[model samples]
Target: MNYNTTEAFAQELDQKDPLKEFRNEFLFPKNQDGKPQLYLCGNSLGLQPQQTANYIQKELQDWANYGVNGHTEAEHAWMPYHEFLSESMAKIVGAKPHEVIVMNTLTVNLHLMMVSFYEPKGKRNKIIIEADAFPSDKYAVESQLKFHNIDPAEGLLLWKPRPGEYTCRTEDLEQLLETHKDEVALVMIGSTNYYTGQAFNLKAITKLGHKHGAKVGFDLAHGAGNIQPDLHNTNADFAVWCTYKYLNSGPGSLGGCFVHERHANSPKLKRFVGWWGHDKSTRFNMRKDFKPMPGAEGWQLSNPPILSMAAIRASLDVFERAGFDNLRQKSKQLTGYLAYLVEELNNPNIRIITPSHPDERGCQLSFQIKGANKSVFDALSKANVVADWREPDVIRIAPTPLYNSYTDVYTFIQRLKQVLA
Candidate 1:
């Protein structure tokens, strides 16, 4: 599709967008001159919902009006606050409500899930992760290995892209599993790699891991809202994602978790649990024996942070109103438009590393600017284009369907063209 570099063309698309009204729902960033900046960095931190301030303010008022009683008397009721988010979040990830829970931060949830799913047994103690997994994930896995008194160098394996490629091939992953079938115990991959913007084949990975007698899990920090992941159909043992990115939840918001139903009722499964994971009926009794709640809620460690959950509530409400299917459809169109524009740049220096096939990605596009460095990013920032720079030479741009418009992508490409020239 050839996009016209004209305001009229962009305006026409905006007029036809079913989600055009959503752009007003967010508080867009502005330059020092007070002009709204073209924000294409939703892959990093999503724009704040217009209702977020009101949501946070409501919590403050509850604290003032009810104090300790706010747990039960608050407007939204803090006692079961996390439950309010579960249904919407479950919808976002394509999971049953009982199989999902919103709690803790991203790394914290990953570590917690590993406690139950990464259990290393007698000859099957090794774990496999993508070579370029997000730094936080790598650190969490390394620490978990050390916590278990295992040597990371010997027990952790990294699946890498081929010599000149930026994405991992399923064939390579299968080969590794076959070679290490006797030693591999678990496989944890980033559902969509942070830097490459490559969305992995979850169902295929899960099936192969299971065939090798290994459990499969995913860190979906870049995948959750950017792409629709059918966690239940994938049959993954577990998965975790942060809400701040594509979910549009505020900074440091609570992360989400999914535990496959097969393991939901595993009475023999060992986990590091707390009272929050115990049956609510007897939890207040403060008994010694812990009877875990079935499903994803069984993994909770403590009461969630209500203030953060409030921000999440505000965001998920936006998602619920807009509908995931609607957002996803627009996402494909918005991102496809961005890709179309970048390719038309016709700059031999610029090369998109993200897969060309739409099925292999979501909204993010990672590209390398030939012979350019961080100064290239500095130039874009000076022009009020808000894309992010990954180290070396890559810049990642994501046009979120909920808040971004066709004009934003059009203007961003114009600025990028100037910067490159």
Candidate 2:
């Protein structure tokens, strides 16, 4: 498809889009004049599904009518609520149903999974993470090391980008594993880096980590709804992600975790236990021994917040209806269009940090605008062209296929070009 820079071209593309109807499924943001604002920040927060309000309302109504009995009598049954979300989320992340569960926030889930998987011993106590990992992840790993009485400055190894390079190379990771052979206990990486939007090769990383006798985990916060990561196929020890971004479950919604089925029944798996993780059969009885449920459920520390889980259920239904494969197919085209527009700018000041190859990235494109400051971002925001500005000079834009259209990308580029002028 030849890229076009006109509104007519964008409209024509929309007319031919198979997923065009999905745009109506969401509630688009509006400007003061009541026109829908151009939303291109799905990488940070996705628009709400029209069904979301009704789903949440149902739970609220049930709670009002049934009181404590809502646990059993609610329409969706609050007692086993998170289970309803697990199967679909598992499908999205490419994990077995039992291997996944909706739980706490992203960073919290990462810490919990690390508790069970990051078992450091003797000389094999070092943990490897990306140099540019999301701030929360860095903090989580550092705190985990501190909890184990290890110095993070020495125990945490950072897989940095080569000097002047924006993305981390797999060969560097392989070399790090080889150099620190038998000394590293775990490798935790962001599947799609937040700053660069570079999607790592999960299968390769997991294979190399396991070969080195180390456990591997991934933070799929940016990758979950943007890319199809087959966690089971990757043979990753575990993975975690949030629902508030591309999943569009609402702000600060519950997150999810995945533990490969191979460890589903591992007796030696060290986890922090809670009643919700105990066998459901004896849960209400309150007298049975704690028998951890197999798979990801075994890691739950408490019953999930039902209100948040309801929102997740609402969003996952959208994914199920849209189908992840179809969304991904359109995503590549939408983001490719955005990249094409950026390249067409022909500005010496702008440099895209995201990988040029479609397979190596998601919907996000991180770019550095030369001679541009926070005021440039302020100008874009004032124009209602919603893109994010990370620290320093990078501006990240994500054109989500679920609700965003080609015209959104076209409009954003036009605004950017004007701002630059």
Count the clashes in each prediction: 0, 0
Runs of candidate 2 exceeding 4 Å displacement = none
Name the weakest run of 10 consecutive residues (lDDT summed) in model 1: 1-10
lDDT of each: 0.91, 0.92
Best by lDDT: 2
lDDT of 1 by residue, 383-402 (tens): 99899998878999999999
| Global Cα RMSD, each model | 1.2, 1.1
Worst lDDT run of 10 residues, candidate 2, spans 369-378
